[model samples]
Target: MADNATLKAQYLTQVEADLERNTKEKDRIATDLAALQEQLAVLEEDHALLVGVRQTLVGQAEAAAVTPAEVPVAAPAEAPVETPAEAPAAVVPRARKPRTAARKPKAAAPKKAKAAKAGVAEGGSAATAPTLVELVTAHLTGGAEPRSAAEIGTTLTQAHPDRKIQTTVVRNTLEALVAKGQALRSRQGRSVYYSAPEKVTASA
Candidate 1:
């Protein structure tokens, strides 16, 4: 009877140890399953993101294929019309209307008087003003010594302050006079001088 009890006690202790081991194994297995489930969830999210990107790209490509290409059409050219030539028509003279007797001659007379006064003023100024060529010629003749274009321009500007005389214009006029044999052009060193032919002959 004591042997039976000892054996039974040994069996019971072994069963308790086995039950504790089984419980620990079950807990370890549950932890591994939870980690595996989390990995699966991450993989599923990545797969959805990739699928969405691919679908967006495919939709853009489909939209591009559905859109029509724009092409410019040129307008047609117009045809010119030819017309037949006709003979010239005769011109008829219109009848003249007589002037009214009640028309004021005094109003017309004042306008004609103003026009005449303006004409006289313009003619008097035009007659009194000497030409540029005439002035240049008179200056050259009046000067005794041969003068450079600069000296001539200065003298003319001082004498005729109203006239806008340029040195280039004076030089051009001197060159023209030289071409026409009306004036003599002499060069001393690098400076050029001009004088009337009469003055040159008198100085000579």
Candidate 2:
């Protein structure tokens, strides 16, 4: 009878120990599950934010594509109102005075152009100084390689020593020459370059 009681007590103690261990293991698993749930919520919030941004960008792109179609639709409505107003001004004799006055200087323009061309060809004599446009073209065509406007401006600054020249002015002059087909516009990487049309053709 005593052996039976001792065996029952030992079995109860072992069962209690197993129950305690199981409770601890359950607590640990619950804590890990809670942490995983929190991480999943964070990832979901991030996904929602990215989806919102993508939707906003798509909305903007759609709006941009629609806006250009509205321009041609509006242009014809606006053109009739503008044309009559422009027509009278275009034909008025009073407007001709200013235009005739402008043409007077234009007549002398060819003479200056001839002199400038001669100056550029003859290496720019003191008797006939080259214009800013001529000077820019000369500098661009001076080298076998193409030159940037900044470099040309610096060279002009060094050669003249009298006048202050801006790189912007040189750049504008170079563009004007390009528009007139006297100079070639080219790009090397990010920097714009200029050369004489003939040299550009030869290189090509």
Candidate 3:
């Protein structure tokens, strides 16, 4: 009977040791679970923050497109640009042509040197002319039905010997005298003819 009691004691001791080992294992597993949960929480928080940043960047890009200056910052998701808080305002240049060089105004035309002293009137009251006019008169002498301005100018040029009388100048002068009524203008087949207006009264 003593031997049987000793054997029961031994069996009880073994059972108690097994219970302690199992308790230790359970505690270790619970500690690992707690660590894993904490790690997961930290990761989730970081993910959320990254998402907010990304959203903020996207919003800013959209705002820039609208007015190009009214940029906006959104929540997490996209990263935001690291720019200065106070951006410069936009500038617009003035619309005008820049001055480059200096320039002078043109001179006025010269007065004609040898126009008639007395402007002609209607019906030929004879008016004396300047020396060039006398030369023109002598060259066109004989009352021989006035000559062309070109012919008159050529004849005067020959008599003057050293003057440059352009045909255009002569034509202009002859037309001026004709307008003054000192000479008559005659057009025969494109050739212009001029003569001293007859010096006489209209009714005699």
Candidate 4:
């Protein structure tokens, strides 16, 4: 009977030891699972940051693609046209209805010259400083070879550092001169060159 009792006690002790080991293993598994979850959270945060940066870059690229830099336009022909002064002083329309003589609007003065004059009064440029158009005309008259808008702008800037200039504005003024028959426009390949009509004759 004593032997039976001893055997039973030994079995109970072993069972208790086994239960303790199982409980420790369960606790270790829970700790490992929690560490894995924390690592996953960090990875998710990094992925979200990368996605945000990528989206920002994509938006900037789209904006750049949508808005491109302006390009200069070439004139229709190289032949010289009648200048504003040389053209007829009065323009009579063929289709206009005849009625009592009406007053005519005075010709508008060049905006560049007007602006330059204002600047001169404001002490921006010296009274002797050339106007934008004059500077461009001087550059055109400098050489036989036609000058591009960029070249003219650079020369003008070098000549008068105080003048604020934009290449597009210069290009538009050149086109206006062409319209007025003061300048000639020619295209060689993709480049457009301009020169005074009188200067073209001299170079020839």
**What clash pairs does model 4 have?**
none
User: Whole-model Cα lDDT per candidate?
Assistant: 0.70, 0.73, 0.55, 0.67
Q: Which candidate gets the maximum lDDT versus the true structure?
A: 2
TM-score of each: 0.43, 0.37, 0.31, 0.36
lDDT of 3 by residue, 16-109 (tens): 9999999999999999999998778767754553464455456556867776443333323123221211121112243322111111111111
* Candidate 1 lDDT trough over 10 residues, lowest sum: 78-87
State in Å the error of residue 39, model 1: 99
**Which digits, one per residue and each the tens of the lDDT, describe model 2 over residues 19-54?**
999999999999999999977876775455346445
| Residue-level lDDT tens digits of model 4 in 1-204 | 999999999999999999999999999999999999977876775455346445545655797876663212223321223233233333546434222122111232355468658867877546566777787777787776788888888877787788788776677667767756888877654466788886564333
| Per-candidate total of colliding backbone pairs | 0, 0, 13, 0
Model 2 earns a TM-score of 0.37
Residue-by-residue lDDT tens digits, candidate 1, 62-98:
8787664321211121111111111111122333321
User: In model 4, which regions exceed 4 Å deviation?
Assistant: 1-127, 201-204
What value does the lDDT take at residue 102 in candidate 1? 17
Q: Better model by lDDT, 1 or 4?
A: 1
Off by over 4 Å in 1: 1-117, 201-204
Candidate that scores best on TM-score: 1
Which 10-residue window of candidate 3 scores lowest in summed lDDT?
A: 100-109
